[model samples]
Target: MVSPQVTNLAIILVMMQVSKQVPFDNPDVLLGVRALYILSNLIILGIYLYIQGKINKKRDMTTLKYVEPAPVGSGEEPRPVTTTVMEYDKQQLRQLIKTQMMGVGMMGVMHLYFKYTNPLLIQSIIPLKSALEGNLVKIHLFGKPAVGDLQRPFKAPQGLFGMGQGAVKSDKASVENAEKNWRGGVKEE
Candidate 1:
């Protein structure tokens, strides 16, 4: 069975191929197509924002339960930190939404610009549009949910480019040795 992603990609490719064959000689047709594309993107953006709002509301309604540590040497059972649980941080949510909106605005502008001069270029943005609308891009970009596995501030993996295990020190030593050799040759001359 073909995966949905593959199917979607294939469909897009076919559409692009078909569009390339058709001559867009009529300015009215081109304008209409551009308008339709922009309208579709606007609708998608609206739906995406709506879904994010709903998700944020649901998340805000959630409570974080905290248990107090037992007193030292008392062995008393720990009590709840407070009767009320903390809601999701409003500032973080606002930042996340802001980031998403920025991405939407940027993409919208690019799409609008490209749809007129280069309709084919607009096709390249389909995946980005889908990802943005689905909120997948936001999670990675904004680090939303702040506490879960998908939390923000991803760390770069170690050992990139073979830089692990005192590689920098060794490189410095090698460079110093080479410099000394060059200086020694100059002195001999």
Candidate 2:
């Protein structure tokens, strides 16, 4: 299967092509697309809120331990991360929410401030699609087991053009090493 990044790119390109055909200069059409954009944002927000509720209900408190990979070319040792599933899930949700907010802010600037209307239509569809395909949505909303790709500390997202590596170091030995190093006063950088 194609990666989500690739799929998202394809969708954006297709939408851009479609957007060109839209009569944004026309007042009625622009109004309709703006309404659609608002509706889409609300729907995604509702889905995230529902998933948040589900996560709170489950309250999975299982201990989750892993070694967080150091930043690229930082010459730093990976740091050991220890957190409960509930905490981890909440952090992930916060990240998602933050991302959604940023996107909305950007769209607002483009559509409302800059008077650019093409993105209003494209943004509407892409975000909803992304929310539905999100890892949390798959696990909590769709009831997929948290294994494989859906596993905790999800493999760091592959970088653009696949140049960036995840190297999360979640294996038992790596985790232990990181923990020992952390406790031994080994400076991270």
What does candidate 1's lDDT look like per residue over 24-129, in tens digits? 6677766665666566556655655655565555454443333333455675443332222113233334554565566556656765656443443344356335
Task: Please provide, for model 2 over 8-41, each residue's C-alpha lDDT reduced to its tens digit, 9 standing for 90 to 100.
Answer: 8998999999999998888899889999999999
lDDT top scorer? 2
Local distance difference test scores for all models: 0.46, 0.88
- Lowest-lDDT window of 10 residues in candidate 1? 162-171
Candidate 2 global TM-score: 0.92
Q: How many clashes does the backbone of model 2 have?
A: 0
TM-score of 1: 0.39
Candidate 2 CA-lDDT value: 0.88
